[model samples]
Target: MKSYKGRGVVLHTLKYGDSSLVAYLLTDVGGRRSYMVQGVRSRSGRGSKLALFQPMFPVEFEGLESSKQQMHRFREVRAAFPLQGLPFDVRKSTMALFMAEVLYRLVRESEPNEPLFDFVWGCVGALDAMQEGVANFHLWFLAHLSRFLGFCPGNDYVPGAWFDIREGLYTPVQPAHTGVMSRECSAILRDLMACDVRLLSDIGLNRSQRVEFLNAMLVYFGYHLDAISAVQSVRILREVF
Candidate 1:
């Protein structure tokens, strides 16, 4: 096996045996990779390492890789920074879960994507610092993430036009297929297309509006990426906000 060092965010983890676990990560060097970590669930001293695997936590790891193995080994893991709010805040935690799940399904590259990694890392920093407007954060995050995924739904708001989910663009008329968004929600998306994430707290939304736009963004995502059938964390997120 070859050794490499990189920074990554934990996306998902599943129990492997009684005390071991398998984790999926989006890393700066390896993109999306899985690692087998033993003793993460134990009452022994090794269990303390579990904190390094929280969703959306920025961490640096040294990895042992080989072509013959489907999962690699990561060691010497350390948190890049302490997240102030994401781990403690209920709404932000739910948002992190939903965003992580979306990324887990969408980010499939085994090669490096420097810009994409930077985007996720920066957004996580902003999410940890923000104290308000948590509801709109995920909406903006997905809107910007779509850009990196190559299906950026551009903001082309016509007076009576629809945002075509399948086309990943705007249209003057309703799309023939079921992949479309109304002008109102499309307007919100248009605003999000250029809004700075640091100002996510400034974006205002009622509960229903949040529900509608989030669903619209998911539909837009579903049209481009078939793997994302549903985002389960959204249910708890809706309740928190």
Candidate 2:
């Protein structure tokens, strides 16, 4: 067994027996791994709260990685920091709910990617710090995530152009394929592609605009990744928005 120390974000979890859980985590050092966390329900099992394993929660852990087994065992763990605004704030909470599902489905690799890990950690922290204009953050995140997922959409959108989601580029005419963003939505896409993440709040989007853009991204991501069959939190995100 190899001893490991790393930071990670919880992506999903499943309850096991009565006092334990099976958690899927995206780690900075180990990439993706699942652990059977014990004593979470009982007060006697190391005092580690089950909330530490909730979706999108950032944590630091010490664990054992064994070559013979796929599921690793965590010896100890703690929250990376208090994400003050995410849990209590409804809009951010819904966004986090939607995003955690997306990442759980999209980020499947089990190899160390420090850059990807940093981006995930940073964005979660950003959401916690942000106080306004959260309406566009999810779309912004999806657009930027394409860079790491190997299909960064081109920013060459023109007045009459449609964005071919599968092509990840713009064209004067829509493609024969079903994957395309409308002219107005395409313009929004270009702006999002060009704008920095920190300045996403500066861009104004009404509720319809937000939903359309988010749906476009969902379709785009679904076209590219086979694992993302559906995003269940999308409707909830929209309803809460």
**What TM-score would every model get versus the actual structure?**
0.92, 0.93
Candidate 2: Cα lDDT at 106: 85
What does candidate 2's lDDT look like per residue over 90-208, in tens digits? Answer: 88878888888988888889999888888899989998888776888888888888888889866566787999987788999889988899888888988888887778878988989
**What is the Cα-based TM-score of model 2?**
0.93
Across residues 1-241, which tens digit of lDDT does each residue of candidate 1 receive?
8999999999999989887889899999979999998777777665467887888889988988889988998767789898889999877888899889889988899999999999999989999999776779988998889889998866556666788887777888788888789888888888888688777767788888888888888778887787777657867766776
Model 1: lDDT of residue 101: 89
Model 1, TM vs. native: 0.92
Candidate 2 clashes between residue pairs 3 or more apart in a chain or in different chains:
none
Query: Pairs clashing in candidate 1?
Result: none
lDDT of 1: 0.85
RMSD of each: 1.9, 1.9
Q: Worst lDDT window (10 residues) for model 1?
A: 153-162
The numbered model that scores best in TM-score is 2
